[model samples]
Structures are given as C-alpha cells and as structure tokens.
Target: MPGRSRPIDKFAAAVGKCSKESAVYGKCILADYNNVHKDKCAAEFMKLKDCYLAAYKKR
Candidate 1:
C-alpha cells in the first residue's frame, strides 16, 4: 500500500473532518469546564463521536 496514510494520520484527518462537531461539543464542555458531569453534553458528544467515526471510515 504505497503512500497509504498511517493510522495516526488517518485519525488526525478524521478529526479535522469533524471539526465543526468537535468545536460545538468543546464549547458545551467549556461552558462548565470546572464541573463536568455525566451526560451533561451527551447529545453534542454523540454528534461529535458519530461524525468522527463516519469520517474515519470514509478515509
């Protein structure tokens, strides 16, 4: 597989692909950065996770 991306590179690209979702979820967490709790941002987190997985699979 000449020129194939390394796993880490693929993962990084996947993260870049989901930047919007990441930023949104990040903001949600940052709002309560000092006192994070379970499921506080579950919806946003799930959106980011799903985006990442889809992007990763596409690469």
Candidate 2:
C-alpha cells in the first residue's frame, strides 16, 4: 500500500503567504532556505513562526 501524504508544515505555508505578499522575498527564500535568505525576510518569517508557535501552544 502507498504511504500517507503528510500535511504541509507551518513554515512552508508561511513562505507561501510571503510569496503572495512579496515576490522578491518569496523567490529568495524559496531558492535558498538558509541563513542568508532567511535574514532577508526575517520580519515576515518571524510573524509566521510566532503564529505557528502560538497555535501549537494552544493545541
């Protein structure tokens, strides 16, 4: 039998949102998910991370 497909992670979903909001930041992070690119979108990513963490804490 085929294995189940897991749902997308919060960070990835956040990245998608960032992409929609800012094409440049989106492309940068998507191309390279390392410290350098992450620093470029630190603010946006931080918001997403906080939101994800909050939701997780509630759960």
In model 1, the Cα lDDT at residue 42 comes to 99
Quote the lDDT for 13 in model 1.
89
All-Cα superposition RMSD per candidate: 1.3, 7.1
Compose the digit string of candidate 2's lDDT tens values, residues 1-59.
Answer: 36643345544554444433465445657766665632687776666566655554443
Instruction: Please name the candidate that would achieve the greatest TM-score relative to the true structure.
Output: 1
Clashes of 2: 0
lDDT of 1 at 46: 95
- Extract clashing residue pairs from model 2: none
**Local distance difference test, per candidate?**
0.93, 0.55
Q: Which pairs of residues have clashing backbones in candidate 1?
A: none
Off by over 4 Å in 2: 1-38
